[model samples]
Target: MGGNEQKFIKEAFDTNWVAPMGTNVDLFEMDLKTYLSNNVHVTALSSGTAAIHLGLILLGIKAGDEVICQSLTFTATANPILYLKAIPVFIDSEIETWNLCPIALEEAIIDRIKLGNKPKAIITVHLYGNPYKIEEIRAVADKYQIPILEDAAEALGSSYKGQKCGVFGDLCVLSFNGNKIITTSGGGALVSHSQNIKSRAIFLATQSKDKAIHYEHSEVGYNYRLSNISASIGRGQMEKLDEFVNLRRKMQNFYKQLFENVKGVSVFEVPNEDYFSNHWLSVITINPSETNGIDCDDLRLALESENIESRFLWKPLHMQPLHKDFPYYGGNIAESLFAKGLCLPSGSNTTEEEKARIQNVIKCLFKNKIKKKIKVKSLFPKRQRLFEDNMLVNFFTKNRLETS
Candidate 1:
């Protein structure tokens, strides 16, 4: 944690304004507006998920409605639909960006419309701080007259075509969870172009109360307002937001440089110059054939053996048992990505010694795989080795795995 975080919290206490609304919350909201400038109004909330739920409600989503959601993202992006009793029609990701597939999204829209259930909104995500196909997805949403609620939970500093991601959606959400680009400890904000929408969101977030001297509740409300204490942390985080984004990018570049010559791995990259991501988590796909049958799981195990924390990418939500019956479009792009992809440690505070250890483990894993394949090929032609290796035939059977 940065030193200034305590300063803001102190201010909150000093001023005796420690409720959900206070000086800190106002400062936090202003900071967001200044950073995300695009005629956007910001409302600090309890969580990014709460922001999405409220955004959908402001967009007229009600019980039993349908919202098309990207199937490859975290469940937080889709769970809010259930909060409103809205059926989340999942959409698949394209191979290029591992984001919402425009074609599949369009097909889903057409079919749903045919069934007389035109989706109330399209919930797209910029996964892992990578910008999705904004133009393509926006085109489909516009064509179908479906508003978009961009889940920029992992993409606070990411942009597409020079426009910040959160501003592209009719209503966008930003997360300040502990691990996010910025930490409010745990908080989020809703951004929108319309002031009315922002006002409505803030009103609903603080509990929908009628403007009366007495306690009068006109509509159902939620306690989704960001606490003053949390907003204090957000205000401090905003001070170093750009630094955090730059650090994240540097980490991604470091990974890209380290893997540039490696045969088995291709670090995930920005699709083009039009996209500028925070590179929240530097990830790569390990091709088994290129790496002598070494896969993502193998690398993960190696890292674990060293007590280093590396993880596989998220399994697409569509394939999850909870949403198993949900209709999903697109081929196996998301599934294939999940199988081969792994997210390396991309924390801003990662040390050089830690990096060296991580890289050494990966390098050794690949080198061993290459050498074993070569020895097997020499022992019994490529075809014979392929069959024999499956049966645990050692490259140096006589030498034996048990050495003196």
Candidate 2:
């Protein structure tokens, strides 16, 4: 938590504006607009999944319409398609970005068109906060005349060729969940190019209530507006967005240095300087053939034994039993990566002591023969400590995470 969240929350209570659509929400949206540095509109919502659902609806998605989605991502990306009763055509990932493969994406669109039901939109993601091939993906989507619904859920600070990720899609989504680079306890936002679209989304989020003396609904809507308290937390978190991004990137550099000399270990990173990643999670792939057959699971188990948390990358949606029957495109690139991938300890708030413990576990697992010694560096070396107290978070937790 940032130091200012409590101050904002306190103001909310003092003003008795603890409900949704308060001053905090307004200012938080402005903060996002300024940071995004684009002429776009943002409406805070309940979660990224909600943002996706609303985005699909606004994009004219309907029952039986096909929507192309990245295969190797959180289920939230695809579940929304099912919510709208639309068919999801899964596309595999490219090695350069671990995101939607443009070739496979185009193939899916062409084949789906040949099958007589053209996809409504293309869902692109920046997996692990690394920006995908934005230009490439956009080109393919344009060629096929499909709108892009960019899931920048894990990429709040990411960019491609100097433009922000959220602004690239016709409709985009950003997540501020508890485990994101920054959090509002739990929330998300939908980004659009026009105020009219933003207004439409706001209306839908507020139960499609018409401007009547009393609540009146004419269309299907959701109770997904973010509460003033959550927005207050977000206002504080926005103040620390750049700080959190730098800290997350610092964690990525930490992993890069740790595995620089490890023959079988490869840290996941952006393909080029044109792509900037927040590196929300530092991930690596293990080639068992190079380290005397040490696989990803072997290293994961080692970390587990020491109680240093680690886990495999997301299993492709196409491989999940729940989604196995969906039409999938492309080769086994995503599958291969999953077999070798593992997410390391990459929390921004991790202490020096905790990092030392994690480093010891990894070094010991590799037989302590690593040439370079891992450093227990401070995440904030020259600034005042940001986290002043756990009082606010503790209080919120005690209150069952507070109301919407």
Candidate 3:
């Protein structure tokens, strides 16, 4: 919680505006609008999932429609497609950004069109706060005249080519879940370039209440409005959103330095300066072969044993039991990422001591693995001689030992 959260909440209580519709909600939306600076309209809602569901509805997705979604993201991205009874054609991630592959996306759209079921929308996620190949993906979508629903759930402060993420899609979704970069306790907002779309979303969110004196509903509606208390929190969070993003990026740099010399591990990073990730969660991919067979799960368990928490990356949706039967396009990139990637503890509030503890545990694990490999090699003289000669020649050739 930021400093002004309690103050805003208190104002809500003092004004007796405890309901969902209040000054806090209005101010929160405006704050987001100004922060985004994209001239987009925002409709704060109960959850990111709710925002996604409403976004799909606004996109006119319905029964029997097909939506193209990234296969490497959280279930929330795909669940809403099912909510509207739409078929999800899952696309794999590209190696560069770990986002929806443009080639696979075009292939899916072309094939679906050939089958006479043109996809209604594309749902691309900014996975773990890193923006996707925006220009390429947007070009593909434009070529097909398909609308994009940008899932910026983990990318509030991220950008591509200096443009904010939340404005890239025809409709974009922002999450304020407790684990997100900013928390409204638990809330989200739907972002749109059109005011009419925003108004329609608000109408549908608030039970489709008509302007009549008496309560009247002409269509199905949802109870997805963001409450006064939650919006108050959101208002406070917005004030510190940039600070949190900086802190998270600092954490990413910390991890980068920690693993820079670690042979088997490579930190996930932006492909170029044009892409700016909030680094919501600092992640890495471990190649066991380079580490003498210490894989990502091994490091996860080692962290757990040290009473520190780490997690494997999201299992690609195409492999999940519930979504396995769905039509999946592209190669094994997403699958390989699931096997090798690990997310370190990267909370904005994580203390320096905690970070030191995480680093120490990881360093010790790698040191021990190296020692064990050396001991085993010593037991075989011929192989040990060959390995030592290779190491010496490579070390001299690269001058790494001299630098150390």
Candidate 4:
């Protein structure tokens, strides 16, 4: 926790504003609004999942309605669709950004249109804080006239073409969970361009009560408002958001540099300067050929044996047991990503010693077979089948590794 979080929490206690509705919550919302200043209104809630559920409702999703969602994102993105009893049509990711693929998205829409039931909304996530092909995806959504619910839960500070990820969709969600870039202990918020929508969200979140003096009958409501204590933590986290983003970016650059000599492993990065990611969790994709058959799972096991936490990328929703029968688009991009991607430890407080240790472990793995392959290739000369037929040479040749 940042040092000021306790101070804000103490203020809440000193003012005797311990309930959900208090100055802390109000300030927290305002701070979020100021931070995301695209004239967007923010409504802090209990969790990112709650924000998504509310966003789906606001988008008019209902029973049997269909929602298009990125298949390679966390379950929270698709669970909200299920909450409304809506069918989630999962679309696979592209290799470029590892987000939603535009071609597959359009194909899904065309197929759904053929069935005479277009999706009511689309939920595209900036997975691991990397922006998707926003311009292309937005064009497809516009062509279909489907509103987008941007799940910026992992991309608070990410941007595409100078526009913030959270401001790209009709309705967007932000998470301040304990494990996110910023923390509110456990909280989230919804951002929309319309004040009316924000007001409606607040009303629904606060139990959809009428403005009557006494409790009155009303529509179904949820107990999803952020508490004073959690909001206080959010307020403090917001104060250090820029610092947090900078630290994360620094860590990402460090990883990129460390992996420069590690064959078969390339740090996942933004495609170009037009995309700016928060680098929320530094990730890498291991090409088995380059790493001498060491895959992401192997690295994960190695890290786990050393008591270091590393994880494989999110499994596509289309592959989940519950979503096995859902409509899907795209080929093996999502599946390959799941098989080869690894998320490294990128906590804000990770130390230099920890990073060096991680680098040493990877170096040791490379020494096992990587050195032998290079030696055999050097002895055989270029264009001669070295250790074995592998994709690394093809990839390197295609990318012009001499210049890289």
Candidate 5:
């Protein structure tokens, strides 16, 4: 928690504003608006998923509608489609940003149109805080006249071409879950370009309660409003949002430096100067064949042995059992990423000692792998002779056999 979180919560309690709607919620929304520097309205809600559900509702998504979703994101990005009984047409990620591929997105739209199932909305995600090909994706969406639901859940402080991520979509969503850049303990907000959209979202979020004297209901509504206490936490987290982003970016740089000389390991990074990521989590892709048989899962297990936590990247939603049956566009890019990527621990609160421990584990793991290669090389004098003859195939074949 940030320094001011407790103070704001205490204020909420002292004033007895413990319910979902209060000054804290209002101020939290205002804080986000000011931080975004975009004239967008924010309606705080219970979760990022809830915010997504409401965004779809506002976008007029209904049963059997098709939504284009990035295939390499958290399930929350796609699950909301099911909540509305909508069909999700998943699109693969591009190699550059590990996000929705613009070309594939357009192809999906074209084919869906051919089948008379034109996509109602595009749900693009800024995966792991890296911005998607925003201009390109926007171009495709604009060409198709489809609204975008920007899932900036992992990209609160990220930007593309000086514009913040959360404002890019027709309706954008931000997550303040425990693992996000900022935490409201558990909450989210929907960002809209129009005040009316924001007002409608708030109205639907609070059980569609009309302004009548007696209990009334007109349409189905959700109890998705952010509580005052959570909003207070969000306000506090907002104060430190920039700091947290900087820290996480620093962690990314640290990983870049740590693996600078390491073979077969490449840190994921912004493709150009125009793209700026929050670096919410530093991730890398490993090629086992190039690294003497050290794979991503190997590295994860090595980290686990040291009592340090690491994780494989999100499995492509298109490949998941629940979503596999859904129509998916594009090729093996997302699949390859899921196979090779690993997410290193990158909490804003990570300590130097913890970093040193993680570094030692990684370094030791690689060092041992290299030593094994060298030892195997020593066992085959004929293969060593082949090295002098530049017969690389024989050398590698013998090496593989010995390692096997």
Candidate 6:
């Protein structure tokens, strides 16, 4: 955690503003508005899932209304659709960016509309901090005249063409869960372009209390307001957001460099300069054929064996038994990603020793294959270094060649 988290959190206790509403919550929301670089209204909530649920409510989603969703995200993104008893039409991810495929999205929209139930809203996600195909997806949503509930939970610092991720949709969600880039310990916020919508969201979050001043409610409500203490932590985390983003990007670069010459392993990256990701979790796809049959799980096990943890990418929601019966579009792209992708340790606080250990583990795991891929410099080269005689490569090569 950033050092100032304690300072802001202490202020919350010192002022006795420990509940959900107070100076901290107000300022934290303001901080997010300013950081989002948009004229969007913000209402801090208890969780990202809550924000999505409220967003769907504000969009007028009712039971049996179909909501289009990206199938490759965390369950939280899609669970809210089920919460409102709305049908979730899951879409697949494209290869360019492992996000909602615009083609599949348009296909789903057309088919659903033909079936007489036009989707109420599209729930798009910037999975793993990588922004979706912003323009393409937006075009599809606009053409279909469907509002979007962007799940920017993993994308607080991510952007596309200089615009931030959270502000891209009609109603957006941001997460500060413990595992997120910057955590309020556990919290989230909803983003909207309309102030009235923000006010309505706040009203619903606080038990829908009426103006009579007594505990009164006319509609179902949720205790979804973020705590003053958590907002205080968010305030501090906001201060160090740029620092965390920079460090996370460095981790991405580290993985890119480490895997540059390694066959079969390719680090996940944006397609172009238009996208800037927080690199929340550096991911890679391991192709078995190119790595002497080593796959993502093999690498994960190797890392685990060394006490360095790694994980597979999210299993597509549609593949889950709970969600298998849901209407789904597209082929096996999400399934392919789940099968081959691995999430590397990319925390902001990872130390130099930890980095070295991680590097050593990976290097050892792929040593045999990588040895054949890297070349040793020739002798008498300018600014020569060790192994100028092509010693290591030639030695290994000669040993194999001699045997052969």
User: Which candidate number would show the highest lDDT if scored against the true structure?
Assistant: 5
After superposing candidate 6, which stretches have Cα over 4 Å from the reference? Answer: 370-404
Taking the tens digit of each residue's C-alpha lDDT, what string does model 1 give over 1-404?
65699999999999898899998998899899888889799999999989998989989999989999998888899888888888889887888788999999999999998999989999988989999999899899999899999899999989888777799899999999988988998889999997888889888998898899998998999999999999998888888888999999999998888888888799998788999999988999977788767667556656776778887677678777778777777777777777678899999888889989988877776765553211111222222232223222454335222111
Superposed Cα deviation of residue 250, candidate 2 (Å): 0.9
What do the candidate models score in CA lDDT, each in turn?
0.84, 0.85, 0.88, 0.84, 0.89, 0.87
Q: Could you tell me the lDDT of residue 148 within candidate 6? A: 93
Stretches of model 4 off by over 4 angstroms after superposition:
370-404
The 10 consecutive residues of candidate 1 with the worst lDDT sum are: 372-381
Backbone Cα, N, C clashes tallied per candidate: 0, 0, 0, 0, 0, 0
Clash pairs of candidate 6? none
Tens-digit per-residue lDDT, 163-267, candidate 2: 878899999999999999889999999999999999999999999988899978788889999999999999999989989999998888888887888888999
Model 5, 1-404: lDDT tens per residue?
67899999999999999999999999999999988877999999999999999999999999999999999999999999999999999998899999999999999999999999999999999999999999999999999899999999999999999999999999999999999999999999999999999989999999998889998999999999999999999988888999999999999999999999898999999999999999999999987778887777557656766678888788678877788689999997887887778899999999999999999878887865562222222221332232233222342334332321
Poorest stretch of ten by lDDT in candidate 2: 382-391
Model 3, TM vs. native: 0.91
Q: lDDT ranking from best to worst?
A: 5, 3, 6, 2, 4, 1
lDDT of 4 at 148: 94
TM-score per prediction, in order, is 0.91, 0.90, 0.91, 0.90, 0.92, 0.91
Candidate 4 versus truth, CA RMSD in Å, comes to 8.1
lDDT by residue (tens digit), candidate 6, 1-404: 88798999899999999999999999999999999967999999999999999999999999999999999999999998999999999999999889999999999999998999899999999989999999999999899799999999999999999998999999999999998999998899999998999999999999988889688778899999999999999999999999999999999999999999989999999999999999999999988778886666556655666678887788788877778788999987887887778899999999989999999878877878632211222211211111132112231223211110
- lDDT winner, 1 or 5: 5
> Residues 35-145, candidate 4, lDDT per residue (tens digit)?
878899999999999999999999999999999999999998899889889999999889889999999999999999999989999999999999999999999999989
Regions of model 3 farther than 4 Å from truth: 371-404
